[model samples]
Target chain A: MSVLEGINSKALKTGDLPPPSPSPNTFRIYSMRFCPAAQRALIYASVKKIPSEVININLQQKPDWYFTKNYKGQVPTLEHAEGKKLVIESAVIPEYLDDIFPETKILPSDPYEKVQQKLLLERLSDQLTPAFGRVFRAIKNPEELKEKFESILKAFEEAESLLEGAFYSGTSSPGFVDYLIYPSFQRVYWLTFLLEIFPLPSDNFPGPGYPKLSQWFKAITAIPEVAAASQSTENGVGSCKEYMKGLPYFDYGL
Target chain B: MSVLEGINSKALKTGDLPPPSPSPNTFRIYSMRFCPAAQRALIYASVKKIPSEVININLQQKPDWYFTKNYKGQVPTLEHAEGKKLVIESAVIPEYLDDIFPETKILPSDPYEKVQQKLLLERLSDQLTPAFGRVFRAIKNPEELKEKFESILKAFEEAESLLEGAFYSGTSSPGFVDYLIYPSFQRVYWLTFLLEIFPLPSDNFPGPGYPKLSQWFKAITAIPEVAAASQSTENGVGSCKEYMKGLPYFDYGL
Candidate 1:
């Protein structure tokens, strides 16, 4: 299935009020182009074929009115029911979307099987996301970078053990577990590029350490929606570098 | 519906395996008698009428093989599919149970409504649970206790604002949000008794501050499953004080 690029993918920022929200019925995803968390929702929406608008808000220069709608100011916030209600968090939005649009049925229909996927997703979130956070935080403090990188590698190994198939869904195709954690994997893969911007150590991505996860990452990235939702490694690094510098850097994709 | 009490509610210590998992089809919950997180799962199971065995393992002295099943060693680890699969996490277990057993559906089935309940539950976990943790940690440090108490009250206020009805499910009865968070609220409510043991200052559970939550707590506590699942205030305080002393204190329910 071809991934549906949303109604608007423009990098909307500061003054932007979200492209009229597409329609009264249509939901707008508050997003930033380079945000990995928001990208998870974007990819999930694409997979489910949710007809929505993407308002790429500026992280550094967030608009005044955006906070009125989502006070926490987190992305992947779903404004639905004509703004009477909102749903935030990457995992909750997709589960809600899966319910509204059941045709593709990436989430298993059977009671037991669906939960295995949720469990796998939870395990992945626990094992990988925290390690990724540590790596990002350790970038400026080069002393902690190596230890944090090792933790991420160990996390990758944990991820690899959870997979007996091409994906954590225990099937050939990508599922909830795959879509949600792909953003983290892509970031880690792109972090190999970090040597270019900030450097004090050797890039030791040991081939023997994460053979399964490396293979899985290569496989899932080729899928249509993943391609659509993912920003280039170049864009990721450029925006991320500026973001680390505390500068407004939204146009990294170009 | 009356809550179905589990087969064995005994405080089984280190060397104890679960009693026969009720039958082959039945699941077992790894729980600590005094744990609030485990109580969330236990109440959920009871509400869903899941006839399972509860193995209340000593949290301080977890058995050797327990880690083999759940290396994280967190309470509320569910062993199911004949022990071939395990589901951990308080929220995920209930979600899985809700899927398998469709009766007495505390979780909303509507895609949108279910998602709202999930969001409310998530928000409650965010606002209240952490404050409860802070209070627990502040027990030894008398200086931090007042600040932590105020934070918990603020969290309680945040919880009050989320309710427009007697419950978060927008209905007359308790739902997902109510049950998941009740464990934390009960803990905080019981924390008011900390002045007796911890040498804390005045117990200021102001009447007007959390009028809605205070009322809601009273109403929800009357529900059968909540009653079946909760420990008494004296027991809770006894267990918690011993627990704070950091000795092996599992039998405080007596």
Candidate 2:
């Protein structure tokens, strides 16, 4: 189908083919790999087994196109195949993946479960993300780092209390919540291990600690797709420390 | 079917039902009538005739439970239902509304359009929201106010260019994008007129110039339920000017 025909005929899902006249402009994922926001879309694409070319942006020195696409100059600007068909925001992009590849069904099928999944995912995105960002930023200050880690741990405890079982709500299979939590947990591990703020202590949850949550995390990460998406120890050592180095307020005890 | 049976049956669409509990907790919405985020769930519930009780939250001394339910302490929180569910975040709440009232069919029937709707709504939430928020915050600084107003106008121009006619995309009347844009635009009007940003002056999308959008706004406001839910004009005038009264940043050499 022609590109315009695809859009006009409501073939956005079926029209997965790259657009014609696609120069260097085809399917650029404007992203910074270290950014969690960027990682959400990229990692989901990786899991969905879609090949997306990256445009690794120097977020500090944003390009003009980047400004044109997203005035805020946020990463993970997805330029769709058709000219000027841009999808910005990480949480938003995953829905597109879910749309085009309905069979994979990363999201839950039932609507109530869907609500649960969205809420769980958004909680991680909005609440936990900002908190995690703060903790990582304050890693240089032992006291501040300790407080931040405690807050996360407490938040985890609250989450654990709400969980039905190994997974958050329904079953063994990791759905929306798993995707949201996995990336953040990966970052948290790096913070604990490399920064040595709270130490990689016991895997306790739901029994005076979150042992179930620890096990759940282990199970989700063990999935071949999730395992591949995760960072290796060497990669972790480099990237986490590098992010710490670049922040302007690194030494201010944030 | 019984509420418990229906909930257990996993048949409800997201945001379709009043939520299942042995006893239905009466819902009260503490919200500003113009806020789009609040409108998402409100409009849905209103169309469903869900019969929710309302309490206008005085923004200055916001009640305690509002903080407890939402740490960010933003509004349109629906309390007293389904075991005290504190649904935070605009995107999540809208999905919840859809779950409860699938019959309203505010979302597009096609899966692709649904996903497109999700992405479009999210972009509107993220991009437009902050731009609107920034304008509201910079109301005190007339110079900064003008710059931010220009930014808002730029966003509106982009919206105008993208939209074909009647609505954003699809032939369906007032689907996702319509619900998403309506409440936010209501807010833009409140900020622009009462705060004196006057988008009518813009060379590009002079508010009056976009007849379709202007008419659409009028139609949406004309909805009796929407009009009833809206805030008092005098309150808007008092608060907006009071918020801007002391700050020189808005005195942008006009």
Candidate 3:
């Protein structure tokens, strides 16, 4: 197998902090390979081709120092520059990167559009993310499971109406809103492959259920950087199995 | 008693929709005078002196049209010029106003500072809001209530560390961040008045216990517009009594 496929960098656990930022210019992301929120910043960084380095954290067994930087110790934190100024929160991480690197803009310059885009992300965070989570808990109860699926469908139905172009921002490119919400759908689609291991209902799956969302999903997957940044379903299945077994490993069941 | 204190401008309930936008420049806010999230946008707009009219919504009995504007039917939705562009979400409402009315800026101009300000707001939302909510639920349980109070304290301790100047942005003046978080503390402080009515443990009150937070709270309350925009604790007590009875009224014990 190619080394690229074989490369599954182990997550740094307690007492395993990554080396400091290479320089003031290069920012470091405290990320988890399988974490949806962490992948948000990763995809945004990759799409922008920002000078960034990744330090995958063992979210389960976080180092004490991690709390010093972020008391919550959530993944997708950004540390950069001479002061090593930290930016925590998934939404703000890429935002901070976008702020520092204004040349190739992913966020719309028009103020109304930008704030509206943020509103869209807020709606997704409120509705879609929870709807997706309910699916996992409702697996055994077929009716509740189906209801959760439809709820996710309804959120998409609204998105379908609002989606003017290929992406949320406009027709041409995926912007910050796309990246913010991308992880949720990406995780769902990848989880479909783990049906044998986890038994997520195949029939309940709402695939390309909405045309615009279909296009959006396909277009996002085609983005080379986003594709690289996202974990493969194989890796996903393996890590998920490990995560379920009380020991998560980023590598594909190594 | 003064006639001004009697004014609550009754909340528009089911089928009591407000009139159409008077002009392109004029804006409308769907608010609940007692709602903290709604108050966030209200304070921000007032502080910025944005030309806006408020139409308080009886959130418990929301008008159907409100859902058409915002599916979530959350209060503090901003309606503005031309297309009657709707800006939903408390944080986004002020941001939208800030964008449209840039002459009087509440948000920081610096990109890094702006994002950092947002991050601080995110932290408060994560920690303080829920902690306050827990206090309400844990009212009957002393141990749980005390733990919840400490959680609020810890969150404040972190805020104390970050708060150097008068506000989160700097020492000079309160900005968007201050407005964003103002409602939470405001609601908490106002809720204290209702303690006698609700039977919340009087001895457990961590009233301005922290020096920095005390100063920040005092400074936020000093802002003329912010003070004017917020509901009186008397009004809050009345609303809470009404809300507890399953019929909330904006008026102060009318």
Candidate 4:
């Protein structure tokens, strides 16, 4: 069978690929290098010790191969061992990785813990993503934009405080919640620092309002894996400003 | 123990509670009666044979208790046995149910099958909740409104087609995926049919575009557990239109 076929087939479990010796199947990741969603898949793959062939995609003009694999044309689609296939959306892919690799234990095992993890992750996706995406898009009047920044900072401050008592819920290392949420958090901070948009008149970041969060950001950047993930030239604040400029409908008042 | 204490303590175990005992210690569903999100919690409690106390929330007024339980103030907060507390987004609750009641086996046991199941459920949440939500809210829009409807219908049709040849792929009974997704589907159809928004010069309700989906809707609704969970209401589409009108800024281009 072909490599893609192996990926799309049932021959490979998510975490455990059949030994490369006999069939020597390879895993492939189709995504844009800097895309946060794509990075989620890559992060899991990296932690899982799985090597993947990364295909960086262009949003404006998608390649035919991408369309064949995923009609939706979104990034972070995966071709597994048997080539059975899965496509589109970042959050779902990481969950699939958790499913396949029970040994890795990226997701929590206890049902309630699992549920808590899932909900927290979803909040990151739903609340945090939408809020930041909206901010990045900068869709409101100046006063309105200022108000939103305050609101987002308030929410972020809460999350930062939540992280205070525990490295991860009192554990020594970052587990499911930390891994799932940190990429986006890092992205936000990088943008904020790069853009020099911190300490919004309404709400302050990198200040007393977000002391725990500010500290956590410092701690996260110290991690080698996180440092490696970022190649963004823009400082934390500059990235924030540049992110807004890159939005498709930046002028439309989201 | 008090209601709030039980949730935080994580004491609610599935079989630990003696087969649906009467109130206080029994299950209580804190939900908004009409919210699609709250429906997920209700449906699972119904399916798993867990008894719950129902708390009605008025989204407009913003209940104080709701804020206390969930800092975010969202409904579908579950207060269960043993002082176990869970408060987060709607999409995360079912996994909680499945975890406690392994016998019901709402999700698949095989690792690969689990991956497929998780992926499907997440996709359902994305397609049904936000993506379709945008379209449903735009019923009053002209060009943008039509575009939204087309996209929703397309998603519905695609999802319907994917479920061919099975009650569900991973399990014998309607497991997590079925129960999780059906509520949204149920609400969507009811809304469309009630509103007379169909045949809107853009698409047909159960037309060739969504024939398979129409069939699945009929089958899922017929299932006793799902059927019992639904409160037959005035047409959903009309109700949705009315709901939208009441909102401050829901004008569709004439």
lDDT of 2 by residue, A81-177 (tens): 5545666777777766686678876877666567667777766555567767788778778877877776677667666665667786467676667
Tens-place lDDT digits, model 3, residues B1-254: 11122125677778886566647776667787788998887777677766667777777788888787777888877777743688888767776776667888777767777777777787777788887788766766766776777766676677778788878877487877787898787666655676544322222332445667777887787777887778766777677667656565664454
| lDDT measured at residue B238 in model 2 versus the true structure, 0 to 100 | 49
RMSD of each: 3.3, 10.3, 4.2, 9.6
**Looking at model 4 chain A, which ten-residue stretch has the lowest summed lDDT?**
A1-10
What is the lDDT for A67 in model 4?
62
Tens digit per residue, CA lDDT, model 4, B29-87: 66654567777777777777665666555566554545656767777777665435655
Superposition error at A125 for model 3 (Å): 3.4
The C-alpha interface RMSD of every prediction is 1.6, 3.3, 1.7, 2.7
Which residue ranges in model 4 land beyond 4 Å of their true spot? A1-25, A124-128, A138-152, A166-169, A196-209, A232-254, B1-25, B124-152, B166-173, B200-211, B233-254
> Chain A TM-score, candidate 4?
0.73
Q: DockQ of each candidate's interface versus the true one?
A: 0.70, 0.27, 0.65, 0.35
Give the alpha carbon lDDT tens digit for every residue of A38-91 in model 1. Answer: 888888877777766677777767788888666677787877667776778887
lDDT of 3 by residue, A37-146 (tens): 98888888777777567777778788887876676888877777743688888877876677767896788778777877887787767777887688766755666766
Compute the TM-score of each model's chain A versus the native chain A and list the values.
Answer: 0.87, 0.77, 0.85, 0.73
lDDT of 1 by residue, B49-152 (tens): 77766777777777777776677787888787677767788888898888777776778888878887887788788888888888788888878887787777
Query: Can you give the lDDT of residue B103 in candidate 1?
Result: 72
Clashes of 3: 0
The residue pairs in collision within model 1 are none
Docking class of 3: medium
